[model samples]
Target: MQTILSRVLKNSTFITSIISILLGILVGAIMMIMAGYDPILAYNALFASALLQPYDLGETIRTITPLILIGLAVALAFRTGLFNIGVEGQVIVGQLVAVIIGLKLGLPPVLHAVVAIIGGGLAGALWAAVPGLLKAIRGVHEVIVSIMMNFIALNLSNVLIRRWLAQGTDSTPEIPESASIQMDFLSQLFGGARVHVGIFIALVAAFIMYYLLWKTKLGYELRAVGYNPLASEYAGMSVKRNILLSMMISGSFAGIAGAAELLGTSGYQSIQATFTGIGFDGIAVALLGANTPIGVILASILFGVLTYGGGNMQFEAGVPFEVIRVVFAAIILFVAANISGPLVNLFSKRRRDKHRARHLD
Candidate 1:
């Protein structure tokens, strides 16, 4: 408990998030006023729409699906000091691969779903591996390479969806029933809701990631390398391999995110070239979660609420949906700029000095 409190106290990022959240609310209210809207009514309506209404609740969960998975991907790479910006590309590849497998070979329900999800993960791994390999062998910076790979994947997905896989319609073929994770079967249970089993799958993955990062030897090595690569190398750890492994795992996680969206939620075989912003949102989720699995889960839900609420704000208050983007941008900037090690050291030292004075009693 003491350690937890001390860590929280020392974390400038956490403090910054809190401050930014409050500031964002104030700024949003000002915008609401400028637009001749009542801020209080707008906020109340936003909460009601996002949480109280069934349709809004469903949309909230839908948005969260990719956020959780992609946030996990980013958090995983961060554990090994890798900034994997290729999650956007990895997600696209995963979506493509899952749809391909679902359409190509029709199998039993369980097997088909498994293959589609796994195939998506593999595609993500392959996409991420290119940058990983470059970083490992050629000493290239991963940030630049990963960003480039995102563009490549985006264009590739566009071409594949528009030309080859498209069914002469806006989207590709409908996924085989066997591979779909829609909750259509549970119509009697929830009044024909769109909520699928994919949410459970995402939660399970989060638990698995928590265990992998906290209770395993590989996790330790990954963290060691992340702390200091040169020191990790001197300690006889395979720094290069760990870097590659980190990126692959990160990419795989993001790939599964895409699969979750394609099979479990959207069910569309072909998505737009610029469909969702989950990749970018994942970065914010990672920071808010404090780079922990449990934190990520909580952060994802909070973001879901915001998104849902924002939609309500738009519908009832006449506020623009784009306002949410501005709020998020402000919060991210504050969190990114304020968090650092020196802040932790300063707080720790002050606490120790206090402890020494108390001991004299």
Candidate 2:
């Protein structure tokens, strides 16, 4: 029975997540009907708007880009037993550096964009390194330090955007032509939505992250350290170094997330009325995707579709968009709590059985 339960659990992660999603949608529909909205109309409108229209679909993909990057960032860190809650801060710092480089440099368009992106990644790495160093060297709690750093980065970004980067108006100066990406091609293809090359970049990054985590020596050491730091240490691996490296790499991915948002989507540095909650959402994505690069990407796209569809749901049926967020939260909680462990175990057992059969043959 225990083995069967473990096998069931191993198969349940994806199935559980899917069930949670369906349950959430059903509940959302009930709520919408109770609120005097036509649930079917809202849901259909959402699906149509997110999928049927080219521009709408493109926008959905564009929204997915940053989510994929940040989701992977969170997953990478989580795999190594590090809770990096400072992705928000790392993203802000990266955006600042990208903006600065985009505005100041007089290089060619491609070169300017590349340099700015690299600069943003470096800035994020530096910011993440702080908490990493503290945790590794001083035995401080990374969760606390990362959370504090998030607050600092939030305040710092707001101040910098309003004071140093603002144009004659409140927002920062528009990025120069040389630094701007060519979204026109995507717009034309998608009927005027702002989809860009960033989506391709995200896909490439996902593959790169997969290779790094599954096929590389560093990845093995990182996972070992995460699973059992004492054992890793006994194996002659430097746990501190791996921790720092993981954090820095995680931050760099988040930096790319910010760059995708600022450079590819917004095209300028600006402060939001409230801190964007993408960092927190990344946690949900990571968990649902089972902390794998492929899973993260797919989960992020699922979220992107839901969000994009939610807007039309509101427009067509007058259902509040906040309800969509509620549904997403419920789904995430249920999937995280009841699914992953059993699913992984089942897969592991199946793989082991296969290996034994092959060897015997």
Candidate 3:
């Protein structure tokens, strides 16, 4: 038992992530005490509201649905050593295309939904492809391009929504029933919580991402390139192609998230002056999960629970929701700090040098 425990504790990444979470919670509790609130009562109310009731549970699952896909999008890019900040842009364009297809295309019920989902994925892929192409061909950094693409996608989407789709309105028409992904039986089971079939789609996507990254030839190439692009190129792999393909694949996952949102959650495209922040949250989720598919699911669940339950903390315990946000930011910060090997090494070096110089003197 001691040996087993030792081995388990030796996994630095796992230990770091767990410690970060605990420390974040500890900080939150301290803040609550300082603010004259009972931390235990607030936490209890949060979990109770999020998990103790069927309706809230269903909403939690619904929120987790898109997060799963978004996390996967960011995770895949990280696995391939590509920073896909364009996921937000991909999601925006994906929604725009999915809504348009859902409104304009007439088809059978199942087919209509399928087409909308596919359109969203393709749109995302196309949007992400531009940055990937530039990065591969011109040595441009993906982060810069994707960040700019986010603004472009946002403004373009707003224009399309106002001028073409809604006739000067800020939102588009609700999609037809044929394009809806809601499962009546599932919703009824969850006490009319508006959960949809997209959960299954998200699960399948997770499985596929796992299989593609760890079990197949293409997965091997992507991982290899991520490990060492120069070595991969020397071994006959096309670095440029892999770079582009990985970004496109990542974008497609983000696009599917957008499709799931429109078909099951929102049902219409609204002109947004601000980002939804789901794509950005995905970056945190991917990092928190250590860029693994299964990890992403767990991390997404953690985030989803907090998101759905924060309101209850406010209502039942008189704790402000901003406290929850601080806890979240702290978790990310600690996780980053723990994983920063250079920072740790630098401190260790300074300590050693100071001790050695004192001995010499």
TM-scores for all candidates: the values are 0.88, 0.90, 0.92
Candidates 1 and 2 compared: the better one by TM-score is 2
**Least well predicted 10-residue stretch by lDDT in candidate 2:** 5-14
Taking the tens digit of each residue's C-alpha lDDT, what string does model 3 give over 292-333?
A: 888889888988898889878999999999998888888889
lDDT assessment of candidate 2: 0.84
lDDT digits (tens) for residues 1-361 of candidate 2: 5567656655546667777788778888888878888888888888888988898999898888888988988999999989988898888888888888888788997888888778888888888898999989998988899889888888887788888888656677878867766467788999888887778877887898889989999999999999999999999999999999999999998888887678887888777665688888888888888898888988998899989889878877778999889888878877767745555667777878987999999
Give candidates' CA RMSD values in order.
3.5, 5.3, 4.7
Residue-wise C-alpha lDDT for candidate 1, range 244-327, written one tens digit per residue: 988999999899999878998667665465746778789888887778887788778878878878877877888887777777
Ten-residue region with minimum lDDT total, candidate 1: 184-193
lDDT winner, 2 or 3: 3
Candidate with top lDDT is 3
lDDT of each: 0.82, 0.84, 0.89
